[model samples]
Target: MMHRQRGVGLVEVLVAVLLLSVAVLGFSALQIRAVSATDESLVRTKSMTLVRNLSEVMRAYPEAYVTVSGTTFVTAAASDAGAVPTIQAVISGSATNTVKVDSDDISITGTDSCLSTGIKTVDDKKVAKQACSINQLAARDALMVKKIATDEDIKVNVTTCPGTTTQAIQTQMCVITAWNSTKAILDDDDEKACADSNGIYKSGSQCLISEAY
Candidate 1:
């Protein structure tokens, strides 16, 4: 009887050790996943802040994106086959041409200094300081974002606003200041990563689009 009890004790001890091992491994995996998620979240927050900042910065430059009056607003038709049913309830009076007035895409992209007579044109104001033109500003913004995104092996592209595939709206313009690089942060080349399809990224290229601002 004594020998049998000792064998049973050994078996119980072995089972306990096995359970402990599994628990340790599970905790370790949990920790790794949590850390990864947190890192991704940080990237998203930073990207969003950058997007908003650029919008406000561009807002300071009215000439860069000043909308003309009597322009139509972008709209979706109710009966359109491509319209998403889940979100179509918001489309009012479908079947007619939806108008988007005062909407203008940034037409230029370059590094040419738009300075005049020692005064720099920046953020819609002419100042006695070194500055960039609207085109230059857009280029620099794209470059800076690319630098930030690439530090993590991510790529970024800043194309002219108003995606090339979509038709232009006839009404008022919506100012899209910048596109952040966090969209492709995961190295995923998914379409939602950026508003423009022509600038698809491969692996760690975050595509941030400014839809409104």
Candidate 2:
């Protein structure tokens, strides 16, 4: 008679089943979170690898600055303003140019003109000039890789004060205007070609080359 009572209890069995279900659910949740984390890590790793590869290519051709579509890549020139120059390279996948890394953009920025001891009155002009120079250099390098001619009607315009002042006076004001071939293309089409690249001038997936005059 006592053995019969000890056989099983319905309430106990139900509680055991509920506990097992909870454990299974927790494990499933843990597995899903792990998978999501792994996928995100993989994406970041791929982005880093892409940037590294581009840097290696640019380093190989130190003198050359290249761009595809709207992306421009070039080395930045040094300036006395103690600004850190930046270089960028971008690549996008394409079915036609799988190995080519088709959509590429590169840009370079000269030193900053806003340093504490730099030009005070007007530094924007100097920065603009530097940016123009970098853009031209990038266009020239890009042409070398492709059949595009970068020198069709190049123009360099600078807006400066009527009278130039010495560095000590700090009254000079000017702006540099140059033909930005890559920018022109992007502006004309209103579409960015270089969505990914290395550097500091990224604007909503587009690379920009800018500096304070």
Candidate 3:
């Protein structure tokens, strides 16, 4: 009888340890999820702020920032031409207006006349600072985007909201933003939520889509 009691006590100890181990594992998983959620929240906030900044800048300089050329929207980079960060926007309406932003746009070399110290020598050898041209101001804003986007692969797209008719696409612009994250947040089947045939955001994408009128 004594031996049987001892065996039962030992079994109880083992079972208790097993239960504790399971509990610890569950707690660890919860902690990981919490951290992931927090990080994603931060990313979303940053992305929204960045996209809004760009949208506001575009609005401020509508004529220079983007011009509707036939069926496409286009702009040029005149400041910090070497910077490589680019943003693409599409105006979807009667025609798909594609905007391709890259270094191929106009690059202003030599002293930037937009600066206070920039002086251009005219034909009469007179030197004076000139106000920033509309294109130059737009380029400066683009350069700002390039600088802010450093260290992260950021992509922006302007599209019609899902399920919205093409006719209304011109009035509403959906600014979709995505950047790099530690791990993939997109499910294998849900790639279309953040990306499409136009382009793909970086792997481990944290994406946010904001609509602007």
Which candidate has the top score in TM-score?
3
Highest lDDT among the candidates is held by which one?
Answer: 3
> By descending TM-score, how would the candidates be arranged?
3, 1, 2
Off by over 4 Å in 3: 65-131, 159-171, 181-206
Q: What's the distance in Å from true for residue 125, model 3?
A: 17
lDDT per residue (tens digit) for residues 58-155 in model 1: 44433332121222222234234332111111111121112122232211232233332477678998786654444334323433443444454433
Q: Each candidate: RMSD to true structure? A: 13.6, 18.3, 9.1
Model 2 CA deviation exceeding 4 Å by range: 1-8, 65-213
Q: Estimate each model's TM-score.
A: 0.45, 0.33, 0.58
Residue 96, model 2: lDDT of 13
Of 1 and 3, the candidate ahead on TM-score is: 3
85-172 in candidate 2: lDDT tens per residue?
A: 1222222211111112112222222232111233333555433222234334433232332211112222111112333432211233
Candidate 3 residue lDDT tens string, 1-213: 786677887899999999999999999999999998998788777777777787776566554434334323345432323211122222211122112233223222333325466577789685755555554555556555544544345555555554554412234546666666422222345644464423354444467667664
Q: What lDDT is reached at residue 53 by model 1? A: 49
Among all windows of 10 consecutive residues in model 3, the one with the lowest summed lDDT is 90-99
